[model samples]
Target chain A: MSKHVAYTDFIDCEEDVRIRAKDQARVVALREKKGWLFRLLLGLVLIGPGVLVMIADNDAGGVITYAQTGAAYGIGFFIPALLLSGLIAYVVQEMTVRLGAVTHRGHAEMIWGRYGAFWGWFSLVDLVLANILTLITEFIGVTLGLGVFGVPHVVSAAAAIAVDVVVLLVLRYYAWERVSLWIALGNLVFIPLALMSHPHWSTVVSAFSTWRVQGGFTPAFLFIVLANFGTTIAPWMLFFQQSAVVDKGLTVRDIRHGRVDTAIGTVAMVAVAIALVILTGTLVHGMRGASNLDIQQILSVLGQRLGPVGEDLFALGLVEAGMIAAIALTASTSWAMGEAFRWPKSINMPARRAWRFYLPGLLSAVIAAAVVLIPHAPLGFLNLTVQVVASIFMPAAILFLLLLLNDAAIMGEYTNRKWQNAAAFSIVGLLVALSGVYGLTVAMPHLL
Target chain B: MKKDTLSLVARTDRMAPVELTKAQVKGWVRVVFWGLRVYIVVMIVLVAIGFARGQI
Candidate 1:
């Protein structure tokens, strides 16, 4: 009887083992299938933030910057300059994607944890102030763009503020991003505008091959080059992309797809920037005593050169750039505030549930709108403040980025490869040197 | 006997474990790191100048 019992127990154990093996195999198969599905879903999901961040980087300010660069320097140096700026933008933004995915933290939180409160607050203050100032410029762009069509600045500002509120508050995250992207795509209007200019193809092609600096590195040229660079990889871009990635909930596995999105955005951004330069460089530069060109001046010239249609297109592009960037900047402000204060931060959260997260953005928009309405509101001074604060905060932000990227505890096997570190470090060094040169040029314009 | 055995086990469990110290980052590496830091600072300054110039 004991032998019989032992035999029955052995059979039961063998049957259990068989069942377990089958379950394990089934689990493995499902996991494999799920991973593939997750990759596909992630590819679709991760597409928006990277592209939106890059497009927002090429804001109304950037459009004006490129237009001015072309008018001041022509196509000689800036053609290649756009390519270099695009590369720098990609490198810096790619790091943010990776950092966000690996650590699942926003730039503010990372700074707080790694460097502590002082630097964290310093970074936040810079970001908030810069964002506000930048928001003002975006509104300025919207108003000026609409003003081209005989709309009043106040009307345009109000309408723009209205549109921003509707898009941000009424829409979900996915819808908000898509709408912003559609508006951003309006920037491509410059490409057609550029084609209308009938540029010398050979000269344009040779500009790249020759890599010419045209006037041989004068202070003015250096200033323009640095301005172009600064516009491409501004400080807001870092905070915005990091927070966007966090909000999107990207994981390390999504890094490849995120990179693809970033690459597409970089290409699109550079293409638009180059086209803007081409339009102004061909039409406005050296055209019988043309000087002191701003975006308004450029539009006026385009109207004269290519008639009313050209002017209208330029205005539309400017309006789009402004509105899209305003949306992004406002959202970034809210995200940063939420991250810092440990409040619930997501477009997914309903207004009632996430009022704290939503309020900062709404208030920022209101404040910027009010500032724009005031007469002689130190527009130039505010612009300078934005650039200065962005400059001051960039190093601190990059330091935290590098620190987090290098931390094995957080990054595990995905820490930056040595070559990436080398490239990132080189970019950082070059930017610092340029800034020093710029300071000297400012202090003593005649010396350089 | 059980108490004695448990105490011995607890003492063994509490033995000090080995730890790895973080290596100091130095040489060209150190230079590169600081250089990147300075580069970022300069980039900011250039941006400020560009803004001041109001060209862009």
Candidate 2:
């Protein structure tokens, strides 16, 4: 129902067009280069979507989850477990890189075309639903993070949506991506905050060898473990990154750079996540059974233990986490919907030209922000349900990804190698088992 | 043709989508699909029961 009146000359064509033009230009320019330096710069330029997807995966809910993990268990088992998650995220997402580069299709379009409409609709509905639910958590992070500074929820949530609209609408894809990359770099703030706590370096290093939960195995421990794993990789990541590759005009020649981009992002995500865990583990771990403290309580402890500067940094990091994830999630929803419907889907498209592509994404954000502003909305219950739905949808998403990767007709020479398939299937297997157990635990808390 | 024009032309002619009939997709693929269906169905049922029991 929204309309755009004023016209701007900032946008001319869809991002796909702009990116393809840029892709050719880069190739032509690279042909003359003979040094390692230019090659490195080119690799960095190709890094956008990969890094954005991974960092955004560590969203608002993810920050709180990591904080809780540290508070409850300290820097023991999860230090190693989190590193393993980064590798799993890379393995699963790397397939999307190849899939997009080869086929020039988003994840939803691939499922629709290759698997037929039944499964296609299933995946689409799942993705759109999960994207909306996840965005609500991101908004919750946005509102609550700002709430620390006494900013009202209405103002913060509305401002977050406004920032998204301007970013998506005003800048063309190339410029928009550059701006987002800057925001993603903000996620690193947790690193300095963790360092501020001056965690015991030897003890932190020893965690790899010590690898055991501080508390013995219990229903609560399993729930937290599953929660960490669930946040590590979500279905939107697959759709967002593939569509991003296609939009970025990454061809077979750039696949190496894509892998490097994904690897760097994996390192960055794990480091930040580890940093947050260490921060809480150091300051809040022993205080009145830190496992029981919520993020607000965790923040209070950070203030008391490390000073107001540390508390403010934690709050700001939460804000960054929510903002970056919302940016990526908005794009994922738009891109998946556009691909499924075969609409003109590109960030470079002008407002009028791609409104259908843009509307649903904006609407979803609006709804999420609105829900968060409602009084006594049972956000805790909503948060648990969000994970439950994502847990249910994740298996199907991975199954389709595996099938599409294995398909010779579409993927051609880019079809998954045997070792890659083994690694991917192993991750999928673990995810399925954990999700099933997690679901049952939710349904029957007594099951565990 | 100039490289720019040629690239533009290439971008215009998009690739056809990949589609497969049930007959073309078989063996383990079929079995995996069935297993996923059964898994999703059971999970949905369990979730529904849990919700109905007000166990969120």
- Chain A fold similarity by TM-score, each prediction: 0.89, 0.95
TM-score of 2: 0.93
DockQ of 2: 0.32
**Model 1: per-residue Cα lDDT over A1-448, one tens digit each:** 2212222232333221212222223222333455667556545555777888888887888888899888877898889889988998899899999887776567876766655566568778888888999898888888889999999989999898899888878886666777878887887898999999999878789889887865688877887887788788887788888877666545565678789989989998999999999989899998765546667878889999999999999999999999889999999998888877767777656677778888998789888888988998887677656655665566556656776678786677888899888988787667666656666665456777
Per-model i-RMS in Å?
17.3, 10.4
Off by over 4 Å in 1: A1-42, B1-56
For model 2, the docking class works out as: acceptable
TM-score of each: 0.82, 0.93
True contacts kept of each: 0.06, 0.31
Judging by TM-score against the true structure, name the best candidate.
2
lDDT of 2 by residue, A247-288 (tens): 776677678888999998999999999998999999899888
Q: For chain B alone, what TM-score does every candidate structure achieve against the true structure?
A: 0.50, 0.60
